[model samples]
Target: MFTNLLAFHSIFRWLVLAALFATCILFVYKHFTNKILSLKDYRFLQVVCLILNIQFILGVLLFSKSQLALLFWDNFQETVKLRQPRFFGLEHPSMMILGILLFNCFTFKIRNKINTKEAFTYFSKRFILILIIILSSIPWSFSPLTHRPNYRSLELTNF
Candidate 1:
């Protein structure tokens, strides 16, 4: 079950990333082109928000079941000495939660704005902020502290 959840969480990240990128590009286009915000733009934001929420829930579940997370909780001092465990147990989750909070706050502020141009401008800035947060929080392959998963090794039969 844990492995299945882990695999799902890993694979789902692509969806979240794609949605975020799409939203960012759309916001950038709107801002530079002076295009009025459309219903499609609102829908795209909604989709990205929903994806982030789902990813957060999945991450929490995975964290609870992760042995690395358990070790960190059991012995913070010792766990922090190891980079991978520490990143998984604390840094990743903390930054992700922070990203989520920023995403929500920015989206809420954008929704409250009555002017289309004002909302577009607000979204452009906030989306870039959220994108940076998300990008930084990700455990990319080149990171010495963490490595990307091998999709081929994620066999369902192992679960």
Candidate 2:
């Protein structure tokens, strides 16, 4: 059960990352190009936000039961500052939550603005800030302490 959950989370990160990047780019484009915020724009944000919310919920369930929580409880702030603990326990979850907040804020602020352009402009900048936060928080294997089990992409080799 744990392994299956781990695999699901590992693969799901890619989708979350892709959606995050797309939303970031769209926001940037809107800022630079002064594009109008159409229904499509809001729809895109909604889709990505929904995915992120799910990912976050999954992570919470996984971490709360695992040894990771034990470690986090023991070390708290110090654990979160380090690579492995930070990634799994703090960075990934906090940044994702922060991203959700940004999206919600944008939706709230822009849903009924009389000046669509100004509302969009506000949203774009807010989006960029969240993107930066998310980018910093992703857990790549590059970190030395990333010791989650069974991350191999194996294949049969011919001798």
- Winning candidate number (TM-score): 1
Query: How high is the lDDT of residue 92 in model 2?
Result: 67
Per-candidate TM-score against the hidden true structure:
0.90, 0.74
Whole-model lDDT for model 1 versus the true structure? 0.81
TM-score of 1: 0.90
lDDT (Cα, tens digit) per residue for candidate 2, span 68-116: 6668768996776766665666666777688767776677667675336
TM-score of 2: 0.74
**Candidate 1 lDDT, tens digit per residue, 14-74?**
8888888788677777778888766666666777888999999999999999999999989
- Model 1 misplaced stretches (Cα beyond 4 Å): 150-154
For all candidates, the clash counts are 0, 0
Error of 2 at 115 (Å): 7.3
Q: Candidates' lDDT values, in order? A: 0.81, 0.71
Looking at model 2, report the run of 10 residues with the lowest lDDT sum.
150-159
Local distance difference test, candidate 2: 0.71
